[model samples]
Every structure is written in structure tokens, then in C-alpha cells.
Target: MSLCLKSITAVFLTFAGTFSAVSVAQAQGANVVTTNFNTVDEAINALGTSTYQTINTGYTETSKATFTFAVPSETLTLRYRTDNTGVALRDDTGALIARFNAGDRTASEAELMAFLRDRYAKDTEALKLKVANTPSDPVAGNPASLMSQMVSASFSNGTDVGPSPLTGGDRARGTASYNHLGISLQTGRYSGPGFSANVTSLPLSYAFALDDPRWAVKINAPLNFTTINGQDYVSGSVGVGLRMPVTENWSLTPELRVGAVRDGNSGITAVLANASLMSNYRLDLKNGYGLVFGNGLTYSKSLNSSGTSYGLSNTINKNGIELSGPFQHQLYGLPTNWQFSVVHTVVGGTPTYIDEWTDVSLSLGTIGSKNGVTWDSVRIGLTYTRANRGVEGLNINFGYEF
Candidate 1:
């Protein structure tokens, strides 16, 4: 038994040596296979129909035909696209092998493979550099928090001039007796953890008083534009308000607003709605001037089709206080109307929207006839805002109350 086992072991060793030699020779021969064809088409024809298999026709919009051939060691694939200029080759593992250009077929197979490898390396390095240089999006907070902030910025009160919320102050006197038209432009800076961005807005407004002068109607529309990580986004709102006098010095306005925000790059849309109540108290002063104090309370809600809860809550409550003083002044031997205003946010607990904000504004104007048209008032104003955990802004305003 021992002798028979020794003979079997010797036979096994000889067979293993012969098999190793044959494998090495086959690998060398595979590398020596001719790659001298001038075009990829010529190479595919050399493989012979019996040796290669067709995988598919019209594999993709760009790739029209696909075929594969096996050598002694591994498999190689060739793909033909719609255009005649080039074809792509891949290894068995689906890794890019080479891109064969029919028009410029000067490079041999080894040289072409080397060139592709170098190009791939350079392209990968370039991509890494680009990502490092590009700025990230100024995300205010989580997706929900961002959505809430956008709604608050675009649909919140004070975006436009209206009839009697007088939340800031009355427009020029006798201004309510006729139609009031105005435009406001503002640029804001928003800051949050690790990010910041600039936001711009334009608002147009119209208002009219009823025959009783105690009742009024107001309409406001505003467009807000912002860019995040080089992508553009737009938000807009439309609001309607009704003013009802509560007493001699107090008034109330109820407002309803509908708003939308769209992302230009992703084509995502968010819709929001707001309901608000605004009130004002006037302290009559001497000579057609007065000091006014007011407050506004608003509830905002938003939703998107993507099923993401983009709002902090279905109902976010916000409130703020406003003060204004309007007085008469002499400019160039004529009486001019001048006003100054200040607004501050005062909400309880952690603010879902604007945690802390303050705004100050000044305006100058006159009421008279011009260009044969009776003018109630023509005014221009400037505003500056300071805020924390929200947005700070500078504004320019124009109005024609007639």
C-alpha cells in the first residue's frame, strides 16, 4: 500500500507541472494576438462570425449594436453607437477598455488603452477639484425649516402698502380718499448655521377706500427671487385685505394670502396659504401729524407634491409690533409729508419662523395735482432691517396715491 501511494503522488506532481506550463503558454499567446487592424470594424471582422456572439441591437438611444468575443483568458465587448465616428470597448467586468475612433485610428491597441487610462485619471482629478471649489447651497435649516422660512419671507405682512392695516402708519392724508398704488423693492441677506445667501423681492400694491371712508379694500402681489448653490428659485404671493374701523383711534384688517415657490433646476413646487389679523391705534398730534402703534398676527401653512413635510408645522403662528410717526415739513417753500416707522417681532417660545427681527423706514412726499391729473400723494421711502435667525434687508419704495 505504501508503494502504490508514492507512485500516485509522483504522477500527480507531473500532471500539475504540465498543466501550469500550458496555462502560461496560453496566456502569452493571447497577448500576442494581432491587434494591427486600422479600424474597430476591421478588428471585429477578424474575430470571425463563429467565434463572436451578437448581444443586442439598439441597446440604448446612443448605442445601436453590441457584440462580445472570448479569448483564451477573458471576454471583450464592443459597442457601436448611432454615429460612425467612434465605438466603445469594455472588459468582461464591464469596465471601460477603450474608445476606438474610426477617423483617427493611428494609435495601436496598447497605445489607445494607455491613453484612455491617462484620460480617465485626469478626468477624475478634475472632478474632485471642481467639487472642492464650488460653494454649497445656503440651506437655512432642515428641508422643513427652509420651506417655512420661504413662506414667511414671501407671504408675511408688510410686504406691500395697503389701505388701513396702518400697521406701520397711514399713507399721506387724503391718500385713502382716492386710489393708492405702490411698488417696493428689497434685497435681503439670510444667515443660518454654516451658510448665507442674498434674496431679492419686488411687490406691487393697490388699495381703495369705500364711500364711508371707514371701510377699505387692498390687494398685494409680490415676487421673491433667490439663488442657492448657483440654482435659481422664485416665490410669489397674492393677498387680499379688508379694513374695518373698530373705533375712532383703532382699526382692524383681516387678510388672506396664497403663495407658491418653484425651483428652476429641480422643477419642484411648494404651495402655501396665510391668514392674518392686523390692528392699529393712532395718537393724534398737532398740525396734521400723529404717532401710530400697531400689531399683526399671522398663521402660515405650506405643502409640496413630493410628500416631504417642508413646513415646521401645519400652522405656524407669527406676531409683531409696529410704530410710526408722520409729520409735516417745509421743502422749497412748500409743505411736504414725512414719516418714520419701526417694526419688531415678538413671538413666544422658540420662533418657528423669524425669531428676532426689527425694521426701520423713512419716507417723504407731497399731495397735489400734476400733469393735469389730481394726485393724492407721491412718495419715496427707504428702509433698513436687522434680524437674528431670519433675514435682514434694505428696501426702496415708491408710491402714487391718486
Candidate 2:
């Protein structure tokens, strides 16, 4: 029994050695079979009437057919072809698997084959999952069937004029505004999958007063200035947004907005338009610990009339990143839900300046105090999101989502 086992082992070793030597020789001469077909179609036609051709051994001759060959039994099969003239690997299925054509240079067949083999061996399951979870359109979850509108009135007091230097000391000359009356209306739509959109508008009116008689005297002496102590500024904005689920707990949203400022005294107006893209992720925490976080980016531009070119030429660009997470009621019985966010804005193009005494003027072809300015604030508030109500426009008011 020992002698028989030894003879079998020796035979196996000899066969393995011969197979390895043949493989090495084939590997060294594989380039002799290279082709110049740019595409699978060209290669298939060049193969002529031969249904199959043998190239590398062990790989069946029937499996070596060009892309265009018809295999009645197998409905699907993967084919590989290379264009020795260029650095592209053209798959039998017409897909350009890889390209090494970097302008004027061409890659050798061996280099191209190595690249194709590496890519084919990579793990693609994660990439497939990511693509499958991405949404192609907007989706608003849950359907709220209520509609309502809200009107809010507020009072604000501030000064439009700044203090100037007096003979003996610096004094706040000019005027101050007080008891401003402002009204806002929020209209909501509650229908279709748990989705709601709100429209808000605000108009303000104020009373103005002048201070420091000396500063007024100096201005009127040099230039015949008529002090219009009071002025009105009206600002309005409209926004529309919708959210839809791409997966079980992930959603995407797109929003568009337009804002305008009209001076009641000069009847001049400035307009700004913005667009935003946002995504929300829902995290499953324990009861009363569920959190939803989101982030978004915005692009805005300003516009003004041609004749009255405010020195800044009405050019402004801004981009911001924000993050907000909502936590449920846990230890504290506080029914308040909290969210926080920070936004950094980059300002570009021309600056704007408004003189309290004279007409508004454009300066530096850019608008704002600094070329780039960032304004970030955080707030926490409670949320009352209800579903299936029959009002016209009332929904929810919360901070911006990142």
C-alpha cells in the first residue's frame, strides 16, 4: 500500500509541473493574439463565419467567440476585447470597461489587461446599494389633510441713522425709528402624502424722528437738504418645497425661493432668487429618542433696474452648509423638540451703501460690509406636526434644516 501511494504522488507532481510550464509560456506569448478592433462589432465581423476560435487553452474554444457571435443555448455571457491601437477595453456587451487613452499616448496591451483585471475584481456591492437608495424625484411622506392660514402682527423699534461727531464730543445726530408695525401671513397646504408647503409675506411701517439740531444745521447749510424724517421699506419672500422618500428612512427635498425689497419713499426695488437641495436622514433611537437630521446648500443672485444702477450693480453670491438634529422627549417631560444649525455665507461682487440724507448709491461693485461674511445662529423650539386636518394653509413653523 505504501509503494502504490508513493507512485500516485509522483505522477501528480509531474502533471502539475507540466501544466505550470505551459501556463508560463502562454502568458509570455499572449500578446501575439492582440487585435485592432475598436469595438465588439468590428471584432465579431472580423471573426468571419467561424463560430468559435481557440486562444488561451483551458478557456474553451466556444467561449472565445467575438461579441457578435450568437450562442443559442446561453442567453447571457460576458465577453472581453481590447483595442491594441488605443488603450480602451471594449466589453462584448458594448460597454467601455476602461480607457487608458491619455491624449497623445497609448497604453500597451499588457498594461490595459492589468487595469481591466483589477477593476473587474473590485467589490461593487456597496456602490450598487448606494445607487439603489438614491431618489430620482421629490417625495413627501405621510399625508396631512388639513388647511389653514395664520396672520401675525409684531412691533419693532430701531434707528436707521448713526451718531456723528459734534464740536465738543461725539453725539448721535440724525434720527431714530420707533414702534414699527409689521404684519405677516403664513398660508399652508395640507394634502397628499404627509406633505405641506407654506407661503409667508410680511409688510412693515414705522415712525421716524430726528435728533441733535446742530448736525441738521450743518447739513442744511452746505446743501439745501430737505429732511424726510420718516421712510417705509417693504420686504416679501415666497418659498415652495416638497420632500419624498428614497428609501425606508431617507428622504430628499428641493426648494425654490424669491425675495424682494421695495422702498416706499423712492419706489425703488431689489430682488433676490434662490434654490436649495436638501436630504434628511432618520435615526431610530429608543422611544422618545428618535432623531432626524438634514443638510442643504443654497445659491442666490440679486437684480436691480438698469437706469438706477446702485453702485454695486446688484451682484451677490452665497453658499451655506447647515446641520440640524431633533431629539424626542426623554428624561425631562419637556414636550419641546430642539434643533440647531450653523451657516457660513460667502459674499461676492460689488458693495452697497445707503446715505440717510441722500439717494441710495452703489459702491465697490459689491454689496455688504465685507467681501465675504458669515452669519450663524442657533435656536431650539417645539414642533406640533399633525396629520389629516381640514383647514386651508396652517402647518408648522421651524428653523432652517441643513
Candidate 3:
């Protein structure tokens, strides 16, 4: 069946509307105060004899361009001393919003962003509607951007770029506000268990933008080693997908995947063809926190003409929904980025089962001084998946960005 552009457009609009509920948080009339302390030692040294704390400006540069982290406001500086109470955030009316005691794990830099967002994110429908309006459309026939949205999409492209909910990873597609974001390259690896016992997946992925930054693509191969009952086996799959922003705040990604699952004991390979469609709505929350809500559908068809297929099922449909909430803050003074996410998926037609994957990561990037000053973004993270019908999986990932 051919893809329907109109239906896709409608879906995009609908998704965009769903986020209208997020309120546009307003910063009160406070003057922002920034003190440069590049490292923890520096910050610690300055506070040698006193307890001084101020709500630092929410965050700094994100992959997104010119996006406001939070409105500048006078920081509430407090002095910290041994046996001193923790800090508290308050609204204009002096209503207590949240409090963080010293040494509280929930008071980490990442959670600070969440606190700011919870306090300042939009509230009223009227304001949210106003913020949701798309900017005046760019001139017609203009050249596509080489780096604006593309940077966010390509560098942060999810590991599971294919349609199947089984392998889909992060959902950090770039914003739709502009033609392109920035241009960058990224490579990564992942190793984890699969549906059955003794099946390990080691996949390598590379992601980059096409000629136009508005279009980003990812190519990945899932290399697998399976030990069924006793015998050893090997298999892999190749997947390619592209991200296209339909608007300044929404995008579309369609992927094609092909792979074979080799069973060691049975000595049979299950060939599969999978097609997937994904959409994302980029949301900017208070502070430096960003949220992306995505949904996707994958159709898998078995190529076994002989009817009896391999251990892997032949035909099934998978539906998935994802929520990715990432935040940025200064670790000491350097930029620190982290994300938390949950993905729940359901299968239809046959081989009924459910899958849910949750993950978190912390990232740090440095800008080269001379060599074009490209940013090298590196991240390390852990994943935990709890399935209703199969063994759970755990994985670690390391990614580098150019």
C-alpha cells in the first residue's frame, strides 16, 4: 500500500495539538545572576567559610538553537553551612513549590532542571495556545538548512531507528521549528539479550544528515550470537531510516529493516522484512529540560513460503509509545546532559507479548579549539527492560558525536 501524505499530515497536527496542554512558564521580575565557577573545586573554594547558594540560570547551549531554557531572573542566593537546612523554591505569592535538603539524591543537577520545569512550565490554555503557534513560514523555494534541526536529529538519533518496537531505542528527533538544526555525525554500539534465552545482540550504528540538514538518516546492523539449548549460531540485520520534519515542532521517520535470526539447535534462519513509521513532537519545558513524545507502528512479515517458520514469529504488528525527558545543567560549571525515558509496546495478530524498556544516560561534550571546533558529545547509559512474556534484558551503551 502506498503512503498517504494527507493522513500523515493530519496525524502530525494531532500530535502537535496534544502537547498544547503544556503551559508556558513565566519567570518573575528577578535579575539573573551568573557567577563563573568552572569546576566544583572552584565553587567549593569560594564557599570555604559560608553557605551561599543561588538558583543558577537554568541551562546553556543545547543541540537546539536559540531555544530559551528559562527566562532570566534574579537568583535566590543562600548561604550553606554545616547543619544548615536545604534550599527551597517558591512562587511569586511565596507559596512553597519544592524543597531540597543538602545531600539529597533527588537534588542532583538533573533533578534541579525538573524542578525548574515543574515550577515554570506553562499553566493556562490560552498561553499554551499562543506558544504553540508556528512561526511565519519560511520563504518558498528557499535553500534547506545545512545544520539547524539536523544536528539534534542526527547526533541524538535513537538507537532503534527501525519500525519494530522490539529494537527501537531513544526518541530524540529534532525540532520542527526550522528547516535544519545542526549537522553532526555519531556512532555507537549496544549489546543485550533478545526474546529467547542465550541470544545476544551486538549492534553498531552510524548516523548523519543527508545533503539537506532537514533530512537525517541512520544505518545500523544488529549482529547476534545465539546458543539454542547448546549449539552456537550467528545472525544480523541491516536497517536504514530517515527523519523528516513536517513542521517546526513535529517530524516523520520511516524506516526499512531486513534481518535473519539463526537458531543454533534448529539450524534454521528466520528471515524477516519489517517496515516502520514513527512521529515525534519536540517539547521545550522550563529550565533546560526537553521532552519528546513519540508513537510508532511496525509491520513484520516472515519470508518463509513453506508455511512452517523458524522460532521467531512470521507475521505480527507492534505498537509502541515513548516519552523521553532529558535535562541539561552545569556539573560544577561544565555542561552536563542526562535523560530518562520509558517505552511500552504491545504486539498484535500473533505471538502475543508485551515489552517495556526504560533507560537513563548522562552526557558530556567538549568543543575542539582549532579543528573547526566541532563538539564531541559522549554519553554512557544503562537500560532495563521488563517483558511480560520473555526474559528481561540489560544493556550498556556508549556514543560519540562529531
Candidate 4:
């Protein structure tokens, strides 16, 4: 008997808790549950003995007015009208009441508000995107290697060897290898065969997508040791960039980098700035194969304060342009893509840190799925930047998507 009584009390308490929760939910809905009715009978029944006043906007005209009651009541003016002949009412040109039936389900005030707010924001953003979509017709739009158990180097003897040598930091952004989170190893040579000076960098980078896959940001701090006339010193530069997808197959990326070599023991020695833009369009080849073509442009300017540490001139300026063609394929396995590119640049003032080298690179990687969520692949590629246009650098990349 004691055990039976205990079970009975437990069940009673459970039911009581459920009922209390239901009452709370009803109170919440009481806010949005204002004046929901499927028929005149329903409305009248809901109103009970509440008094409502109707305002007139010349009933004979096409215009109609509303009837308002008090607070906590629906404010919408859904009242109907009839001709003097006592004709039947019509739903057209008037509000049609909707009745909601949750089938014994209820939500707390917080839940309802959250639901409404989320739906509103999502719908608003969707509408904005739809409106912002271009009216124009649809258009077509790196791996890492070289690392040991410890810190290793990815090198390029001479990279981007062309009419226009690009700065080691020029064209900071690259093709859309969309990854939510990524890290890459990069190496480059900024000086072109056009000049007798040589400037090189080996950088590690981190990339991350913002709230949406369509937007991403990256920050890079390249600390690779620098060699100036055989005098090697640790170099430092920090770069930041963002990428935005303008369409299903087209995107735009912008980047800015500024930093300098510190006094071997004091403070700042030299500084430079690189502002660059990269744009691309992709054409789908179906079955995990596609084509991407792109262009990159950058302006690099620098000031050398170290004077003699490196041969860098007092001032340097260079403009560069790159054209790219990337092939998308399944590689029948983990290799996701292959790319080829060419660059040209024009140099004005000779800045020791700036170079006019043409560059070419090829990469392979893939974005796959594991448990419904997407996972980006490890990308690895080889690049050649030389005064004579030969492979001089190598890059490795790893990324994740959520």
C-alpha cells in the first residue's frame, strides 16, 4: 500500500507540473492570440461582453475604417460591411480571419517572442538579399607542403617572374577555397629579374568564414626570416582581408597589409602597405567538376628607414596584375581542384621590398561531408616565381567548415 501510494503521488505531481507549464504557455499566447477568429460567430464569442467602437470612413465609398477596443486586444481593423439591401458579406477586399490550432501544444511567452523575432529577421534578410540580387544575367566565375615535425620552410627561388613583378604581399587574396577555418603555409619572392635586389617571404596564414559561407575573413602575420644581400633578419607584417560572394559563381576579395622590419635590436626600421583586389567567376562542369577564372590587381608602396640593413631604397612603388584559370575536378579522390595562373606587373619607383615578378601556381583540394555538416579539405600546391618564370614556391592549406 505504501509503494502504491508513493507512485500515485509521483504521477499527481508530474501532472501538476505539466498543467502549470500549460498555463504559462497560454499566458504567453495571450499576447499574440489577440482576436483570432475564423467566423463572425467566433469573433463575437471571443469578444464576450467587451464593448468596441467603429469609426466610419464614408461607408458608401471604397474606403473602410477600423474598430478598436482596449489594450491586450488585436489592433487590426478587419470589420466587414454590407449594402443597404442586407446583401451577404464578402471576404474579398477585407481581412479573412485565420484560426490557429496547435493541437494541445503551447509555448511560453519567451518562446513565442523568440519564434516571431527569428522568423521576422530571417524573412527580412531574405527579402533584402532578393532585392539586392543583380538584375544582370548569370555569369561564369593551394596546397601546403614543406613542414617537418617542427617549423620548416616552403620556398620559391624566384616567383611571379613576368613583365610586372608583384610584391611579396601584393594580391593577398586568392580564389574561393571556401573554408570556415583554415591554415596555410605560403612562400614567395617579391623582387623581379628586372631588378638586381631580392626580397622573399615565408608566411603562415589563418582563414575563417563569417556568419555566412558567402563571407570570410583572413589575418596573416608573416615572420619568415628575410635576407638582404646575404644579411638575414626576422621580418614582420600583418595583413587582413575579406571575401564576399557577389553571386553563385562570382566573388570579390580585398586585402590590406602593412608592416616593417624592426631594428635588429631597437624599434621599427621599414614599413610597407599593399592594397589588393581579386575577383573571380566560375562555370560548373557538373559531377564535381568546374572552371574558375579570375583577375588580381595590387598597389604596393614602401618606405625604407633602416637605411643600410637592406638595400631597400628610401621609397618603392609597384603595380601588379594577375590572370588565373582554375580547373575544378573530383580528382577521382581527395584532390578536389587544379589551377593555373599568370601575372604581370609594372614598376615605377624602385623600392627594395617591391618586385615585378610574374607568377604561376597550381593547387589541388576538396570539400567533403562527414556527418551532414561540410568539412573542407587539405590543399597543397606548387608555385614558381622567378626572374625567368620558373617554379619557385610551394604552399599547403587546411580548412574546416561548420
Which residue window of length 10 is worst by lDDT in model 3? 136-145
- How would the candidate models be sorted by TM-score, starting from the highest? 1, 3, 4, 2
Task: List model 3 lDDT by residue over 122-193, tens digit each.
Answer: 222221122122111010000010111111122223323211122122234332212211222222222223
lDDT of 2 by residue, 131-198 (tens): 12211101101111000000011000010111100001000111111111112122223222322343
Instruction: After the best TM-score superposition of candidate 2, give how far the Cα of residue 140 lies from its true spot, in angstroms.
Output: 32
As a TM-score, model 3 comes out at 0.45
TM-score of each: 0.52, 0.27, 0.45, 0.41
Model 1 Cα displacement at 256 (Å)?
0.8
**Largest TM-score belongs to which candidate?**
1
> How do all the candidates rank in terms of lDDT, highest first?
1, 3, 4, 2
Model 1 ranges with Cα > 4 A deviation: 1-169, 172-175, 188-193, 228-230, 304-309, 314-334, 346-354, 367-375, 389-392
lDDT per residue as tens, model 4, 1-402: 122111111000001121111010011211311222221122222321121211111223122212321111122222222211111111234454332222211212123223333332323222122112211000000001001100111011012112211211112222334443333444443332222212334444455566775576765555544343234445556667676778876666676666554435323354555565655455656454445454545454444453322221221122222333334556336434443455433333322112234445555444333323434444455555543222233333222222
Go through the candidates in order and give the C-alpha RMSD of each one to the true structure.
18.4, 26.0, 27.5, 27.6
Superior candidate under lDDT, 1 versus 2: 1
> Judged by lDDT against the true structure, how good is candidate 3?
0.36
* Candidate 3 ranges with C-alpha deviation above 4 Å: 1-200, 227-231, 305-334, 352-375
Report the poorest 10 consecutive residues by lDDT, candidate 1: 6-15
